[model samples]
Target: MKTKITLLMFALLCVSTLANAQKKQKALSFISGKISIAKYHEREELNRMNKGELLDLYIERIEVIVNILPNIAFATNSNVTMSTLGIPDTKENRKALVENKEASDVYFENTIEFQKKILPYSDTSDLIAAILFYESTLKSLHTYNDFKSN
Candidate 1:
């Protein structure tokens, strides 16, 4: 009887662990999809919005993604990337938040510098600003993974 109870508890633990892992995997894929959409807009050459309008739209889009990442519990060894996350880069995923697109690179350097300062504060705006400046956040995450492996 003791042996049977131990086996049953072990099996249940394994099942729950697998379920949690699956959820994290789904979140990772969703992050990849958002990154792809952001990249698509960044490449648009003909957007006609003025500067203020463009900045507001960029912030709105990035804030949503930043808010999502912290809720997820990723494994220490998990590798983040578009390919590894397996989220398809599709026009269907493109979300145009503004009439005119602005390049994040215009303030990318400044964004990084500001992020470092506000990181200790753990404010929402700081997190969003850090992620917004990445040329490709997914790619940068992958590069971090590579750095870790080395």
Candidate 2:
């Protein structure tokens, strides 16, 4: 009984640690509203949650991506901003975003880059992935390589 209890406690502690580690909230303020999103972890803990909890998180994520579909659809040109937020929130990220030091700036100044190679005439799904790439934990230059692999 003591062994079982000890194992359960250990598991709980591990989960709490992971949850704490995974917390990254990025908020965007616009005239319409404020969006403070706790982005999806790369490990995909949603699968462990109950159906309702899964749906809630999934829907919030999807809603953010969904709203931006029109923007993607109407894109008249190519752009790839390496920063998660178009503007950098910190001095370090600002350097990466501003000096145009990122790998993609070799392509354009206004656009955001994708970790995965997007085919020509990339459609709505591609656009969604690109935006979600910014709003993800993998905000580094190599964003969404996992998404592409999976």
Candidate 3:
């Protein structure tokens, strides 16, 4: 009787652990998909700018606007995940957030500088529109994923 009870408890523990692991995997997949969508949008925006298709004035403002949304999303997501994992969302505690902020700032600055240099050669409105579209798409994807997760 004692041996049977021990075996049942162990089996139950294993099943619970497996279920938790599966849940974690699902959450991770959702997070990965969100990150990938952001990256793809950023790359597409850069490609359009590099093609000299954006106008000077629009490129100048749009580049900054386009980069800001993704930066905010990344920061928000990082903080939320850290909190969910019961980790402190501090600069000293979260190295990934620190690194992400540094890299994103540099990228944002560089994109602006690059845009200024090429503004005279591209169509500003078109560049702005393209960036806006990408951002909107990213927002939609995030919303859909959030709903799906819930």
Candidate 4:
């Protein structure tokens, strides 16, 4: 009887751990999808967003780009920032919004304006991934005009 109970408990633990891992993986995938989608948002779609929403989308794009920078330390620091934005408050799943919108309004507006001046290019390009070429080729094409103009 004791052996059977122990086996059952162990099996249950394994199943629960697997479920948690799948949940985490799904969350990461969701984050990645958001980043990908933000990069390709059409001008009309972006224009539809209120200033706050647009700012939030712009910040999300910048944060992911920063995470993959050359410096290892930058990647680590950006991971923490990404987690803060992506992860829900520990208390409950219902209240998941991590951003303090009111507190960030001033910074968001200024940052968006500054970014536009610096980048000065539309991020909404129709050139998505090409199956025949390398991924970098697609990336190059996407930013080619911007680099040339600069």
Candidate 5:
């Protein structure tokens, strides 16, 4: 009876741990998907900017800046800026900017003061990765838009 009780407790513990792990995995997946979608929008904005879409340029620039603002914030130790105006500092605000939307009147403005501090230590590969991320983001955004419009 003692041995059986011990085994049962062990099993319960294992199950609990597994359940927590699964929950964590789901959260990570959700965050990753959000980030991927944001990256996609930024890439599309970049392409649009390159195609001489002047009107879109302002918004696209904001989107790219917003998409990369987190990394920039970490790198530069500055506040994260928004791509839109009048948006509050919340996860929803960030999501909106990353997803499909136009300009926001309120932006979380931050100075790019850290550029000079970190640019010297930046790696060529990192730059390449950034480009790749932008491209991927663009592809994903286009695909999503096509799916939605169709």
Candidate 6:
């Protein structure tokens, strides 16, 4: 009987532990979709938006992503780029985001810096979620290329 009680308590503890363990947030993919839509839906007009406008849009999305990141995207959002983060290099740019190895490398380098600042405040799961969004945004950027530049 004592063994049975101990086993039940152990099981309860395990269940609680699992429940409390870091769970990945859900909005990363959503943020990715937003970034993709913004980048791909319109290839040309995207460039006309002023830097402040562009940054504001990004900030809006990042704010939403950040709200979901730690419990988050600002501290870790510095590595944003024209290709990797789904922004266009130029009005006629036709580059891919994730598939473009060079672009991805540059993006990763930038993101690493943000991670350093964010890591002290967040868990692995949170960062992974942010990364998923980053990758998704990259994949989405390939949707359409208005014109190719040499």
What's the lDDT for candidate 1? 0.43
The candidate that achieves the highest TM-score relative to the unseen native structure: 3
Model 6 agreement with the true structure over 14-72: per-residue lDDT tens digits: 99898877553222211222222243223234355554444334334453333233311
For residue 10, model 1's alpha carbon misses the true position, in angstroms, by: 35
Specify the highest-lDDT model's number. Answer: 3
**Over 4 Å off, model 4:** 1-39, 71-150
Q: Candidate 4's residue-wise lDDT over 1-150, tens digit each? A: 999999999999999999987673222211211113224554566556565455455555544433232222212232333344565524343223223322244454676578667543434332111111223332453454464433
lDDT of the candidates, in the order given:
0.43, 0.42, 0.52, 0.42, 0.41, 0.43
Per-residue lDDT tens digits for candidate 2, residues 1-150, read: 999999999999999999998776443221111123465444344334444443344445444443333233222112333232355555575454335323333432232233123323444344445444645722331332344544
Q: Lowest-lDDT window of 10 residues in candidate 1?
A: 93-102
TM-score of every model? Answer: 0.27, 0.26, 0.40, 0.26, 0.28, 0.23
lDDT of 5 by residue, 35-110 (tens): 2223333444444343223222333434454544344322221232442233354667556544532222123222
Q: Could you tally the backbone clashes for each prediction?
A: 0, 7, 5, 0, 9, 3
TM-score of 4: 0.26
lDDT of 1 by residue, 15-82 (tens): 99999876633223322223333342343331444444444455544544453344233322324433
Question: Lowest-scoring 10 consecutive residues by lDDT in candidate 3?
Answer: 25-34
User: What is every candidate's alpha-carbon RMSD to the true fold?
Assistant: 15.7, 20.8, 15.1, 14.1, 17.1, 17.7
